[model samples]
Target: MREHRGVPPILTVVAILVLGLTLSATAPAAVAAPTGKPGDVVRSTEITDRPEARMASAARVFDVTYLSADPRGRLVEVKGSVSLPKKAPGPGGWRILAWNHSTMGLGDSCTITDSLGKDKRGSRDKWLGQWLRDDYVIAATEYQGIGGPGVHAYLDGPVAGKNTLDMVRAARTVVKKYVGTDTSNAFVSFGGSQGGHASMWSNSLAKSYAPELKNAATIAHSVPTGLSDYFAAIRPGFPNVVVPDYVTYFSYVLAGLKVSRPDIDVDSYLTPLGRTVIKNAQRLCYAESGPATKGLTVGQLVSRPLADGPLLPALRQYTRLPTSGYGAPILLQQGYLDVVAFTPLTGQFVSRLRSNGVNVTYRTYPTQLHGLSTAQTLEAVKWANTRTTWPR
Candidate 1:
């Protein structure tokens, strides 16, 4: 946790950090509330100067409250973290590495930034630390509702995309103003699992939503694509017992969908016991919720199959990746043995992207599992670096 030479002391900056400010009277009614265009910082707090164990090369860490929109255009306050490297920015400024995190939980405490002060190291830290050493500013989103007001929008791609894109903008603003670390608008997006889904969405939506982040590269590892097929593979009707231990993930998805899509009633898809399980899920994070649903078969969880229900169309619409309009280079990595995202589905997804005229690089590992795919960090980092540094 060594401090850099020119950075301000942790305590001094934290003490004087700005709090909430009132909205201006002359602001337009559309954005007259606490909201503004995406990435506008409502407030910023210098959380710490001492690098956390997971962030070994961080010179300064700040918790930022910024503006982002939901799918329907409602303004919401989103919280995320920005970590600057110890080395000073170059003449053009430090480039950004936006890290969208995997599913932790639907609860507020599941925020990845909350892990900053702990002594333990996260699995991604080894590679994330590598990026820090290479002098990249890391900006991570806690997603929509993890540390903010609304319910966590688990797999909703557009919402997560907007949040991820805005995080980079907020990180640049906060670091330049407070830590004196100049940051370039150039950036790369990377994530796995739910994060992987967000990464693809961010790249797909960048042209229309945030054109400022042009030429950004994306790395999606162990991405869960082909949502309709995924649901069918895990349903109880499958030949053998499938995903007995992972039913909890579906529970969270159901709960999250209920939050985002008000017209769909979650109770309609669940049995009496399923209702109780989902109720309990709303209170706990992933660790607790996963174990809570262990040994509970999919049949017991739902009265009727999701495939037969009216919810299928909506589920397909939200969960599937956009077929085209990706404006940047994409690199997809999948593990052969991954049951969660499934290897064949990822292959199919790559095919679709290629068919749509996207420039995609696909890689598969033989012995890697869902989580082990994260070990590809070094290669992924190098790929992103090359793209971001490429001439516009």
Candidate 2:
């Protein structure tokens, strides 16, 4: 009697079938497995088929997303570019040049790859072209967070060092796929400004972090070794008038430290206007942010003097140069006339390195500005090439 009141068997069957189909369509998809170990290529796309006329020797260029790690060893995705030589690899394979770029900004838009050949400064293009012409495979890291997720870690030495080393590991994958499997395990690290900091850190980290990498040598130019010294040097004159560019640089350092050290409250030390400008600067590239802070003095930017704030201690911790643990020879290049990374401070850092038993070849360029150290590109390439071949 109860069944008689219910729907007929045929209709009941149809309803059951419809419900099953809907469930199947709405079911959650299975999660994908982790790709592989660090240095594994997550994916790569050929962004450019031919190089710029200036890079005639470069066969192809690729934009790559690869697996790396943050300072805490959490898995992170890093984006970078690789340029292969037009000529085929020799029996010994191609040697790698890991180019750690200087400070562009703390934003994703500041990724060096975005303006590889089109940089208004043209310095990068010229430098890279020269490397390619010399038949060295160039692998340039945009650095963690520059074109990837999270905040650009600015001057965090370990993070920068790891990114530099991981780029070389990822470059090996590219070489095996496109160039040849005969690629040399030997590589060199070099950079200037923030990049110089990274280059030094990479060499220091190589033995501990990536023992497999044959880091032949390291070259750092116009290096910013200590932020505390830099801050003291750049403090406003007696009149208290500061270059607006200094304000922009300060903003980058603050923003970077905020991300890397989330436990510290960066906003507590800033004035309301300082907080506003920093927030705006976070979204801008280096070019835009520099001008935005122009004409603003130190007193106008912050409520309390930077030296009196909690930032100094943190800066001191983050700004120290690695005194030991680097295995390769180092070439430190400084500019006598460079006010940005003042010559005197750099000289002191070199002295400390030497005292620590570091084999440092210090070269000072007279009558040159901060950017002039990069003009040693050709000489550095030769230095690295010779070291890789001679191994002394």
Candidate 3:
């Protein structure tokens, strides 16, 4: 109207009104998320980047966003990758592996997409490459918050479990869409470190959370358990002895609590110095952040005692792994000398699993350290294959 400088002629005005209504009714709307059920794909974009798409055995790779729920049962979107094998499947269809990743960090830049891309390729993509070569559909979740909504719930077991299982569902959908092949209902949960922790939760939650998908077996290595006990040692000046990456690991827990437990006032639990450290921790990935924690100690970072009282309960909820509720057999691999996941804590976790009558197969490497268990992956995959519940 201002540009026109006067009311248009009646015919012109009528034409303008008609065009406005037509455009309003016909113009494409902005992209909207799919109505999600747990595991339903919200969207999947092909990974065309050379480094990211160059999987040795992948027919196609995608960066997928799918639905999952927080601990509070609220729906949320989680990002993950779906790698379909180039090789044709046997009559049994594609064997599926839900690969839970180890700790990367609470930052988006540390997501599987980033790790699968050119920035940093660790043993993670290499392991997935093996699965792809062996003719498996691999669904590796980056977890709920790494590149999705909200801050990551670092060690939040149930949440990670949901994301991992849901990724399997999304993988099946993608495999069918892109490959025109059916998938075996049976799938295995496999991961190391934080991924191990997540796989354990997926194993326990599968029967209850995703009855439609058959969780054949689960293999976890160097998983964190009995975290409550370790957390109890964190006081203003505690741990009796400071250890490498303790501050880095604990600060990650705090960073996650910023979103997962808003009532906790996570910042209040920190000292002024602690607050500054946590802000950086939330943004930096493991490789970048781990070195920064060199010489940093719990005593220097925190002012409050997390061992007892109000904070203790939340810590237990966030860190403690479930010992029972496992419907399928579990293979737990541990390294006696592993510093990343202390041996004693894993022992306690295994004991609880057995005491609860859970069918658990335990393997320990006396000479192995945390990541050295990679050599045993072939054996672990064999074990999972034997136990896999296949369709008749």
Candidate 4:
């Protein structure tokens, strides 16, 4: 028995020890990968290098789409990505934060990703991304038509809100496979510019649309609420950047309200220049289009006595506000020097929401202009983290 008491079989002991440790380490990684998956996720990275892919990657690098029902109660689709804080708990265990991208419809399919690969600063804009890093799952939507099958409704609140709420459901759907329960987590909404409007409107419409997931806090930066007010403020300066925006507005109104007003002569309503401008405007941000369309004169687009015109009145009717109030804790960041989204209109919308008894907090940035204003993501995170349940 060659002294078998001591090192009888070193190889046997090594194999047993190695197998046990390997199993222990690999098991947890697998479970956590599925359940506690980080929110900074994307469907694929192969498309990331292409020009179009680069753009989408730039805007929302972590592009993850999930299945959720549309407002019509049908199984519709949504495209977006989630950003979870490092060392953060899973969605149900911790807070879930959802973000809405500004303009470019729901899917604008804009080429910005969460990775900040292109611009170095990228879409996560320093202040905005830092605030988003607190303790939440930030999900940004590409809205309808921007990336997917349907046409983007632009400022259509009901449709936009429906899409936004559905995105939460979509995210929860993905999260539940790992966490088991859907309603165990809390959610907050945040966005700026057009996103600001969507954030507020979606907050208002969430109670009725998807009452399960409560809205913790909503932050808006110079939100455009009242179409009437927006028009009133800029009508006098139509020849400036406002005219092309007006054209774009009418185009969106036509597209969103097409079902309600089928009689609209979509082609006749658009001038060759209006059509061209609107076509190009759809791809640009407020800042880009503002300066791009500066050359167009007002009289060329809309005639005098704008009220009775074929397009002006129709546009006015399409963008009018509904009487419903957005019920959510809100933080509004208004840029006093914002020329694109007139400050007065944002104030009026805030007034309307506040008067309706909605929980709201409004802040104004006296010197910041439209392009220069930070997304104000810090306040949104702080406000959202305070909510215990949904609809905070």
Candidate 1 residue pairs that clash: none
TM-score of candidate 3 against the unseen true structure = 0.86
In the range 219-262, model 2's lDDT, one tens digit per residue, is 88988866775554333231353333777777788777777777
Better by lDDT, candidate 3 or 2: 3
Encode model 1's per-residue lDDT on 1-392: one tens digit a residue: 12347655875566445321222444345534574788999998877654452366677788888988765668789989888788888887887888888878888877776455454746445777677778788888888788787788678898999999999889889988986656777788888889999999999888888777664799888887886665654443433356434667777777767776767766777788888887666667878876787767667777667777567777777777887889989999888888888898889888988999998999888988885444587888888777655432
Off by over 4 Å in 2: 1-35, 50-54, 119-125, 232-244, 373-375, 390-392
TM-score of 2: 0.85
In terms of lDDT, model 4 sits at 0.55
lDDT of 3 by residue, 1-392 (tens): 01454665997889899998998999987656446599989888878455755465567778888899875777788899887777888887888889888888888888864335443545644655677777778898988878887678888888999999999999999878777878988888889999998998998899889998888889899887776777677778754344557777888987776667777766666787888889888778988887887767777776777764567788778777887889888999988888878898888889999999999999999998885444588778778767666662
What overall lDDT goes with each candidate model? 0.77, 0.76, 0.80, 0.55
Candidate 4 lDDT, 1-392, residue by residue in tens: 01245555887799789999998987555422112222212242223343433322122234466443333333344566544344335444545656676655322545233333344446544545553355454556666555554445566565566667766765665544433544334567777766776677678777776777677677777566556544443332364444336544544444454433445544354446655665554555545655666656543443233343454455566555443466567777787887767788778777876677877777777887763344455555655556535422
Off by over 4 Å in 4: 1-62, 67-75, 90-92, 105-118, 122-125, 178-184, 230-238, 241-262, 280-294, 303-306, 309-324, 371-376, 387-392
**Residue 329 of candidate 2: its Cα lDDT?**
92
When summed lDDT is taken over every stretch of 10 residues in candidate 2, the lowest stretch is 235-244
* Model 2, CA-based lDDT: 0.76
Q: How far is candidate 3 from the true structure (C-alpha RMSD, Å)?
A: 9.5
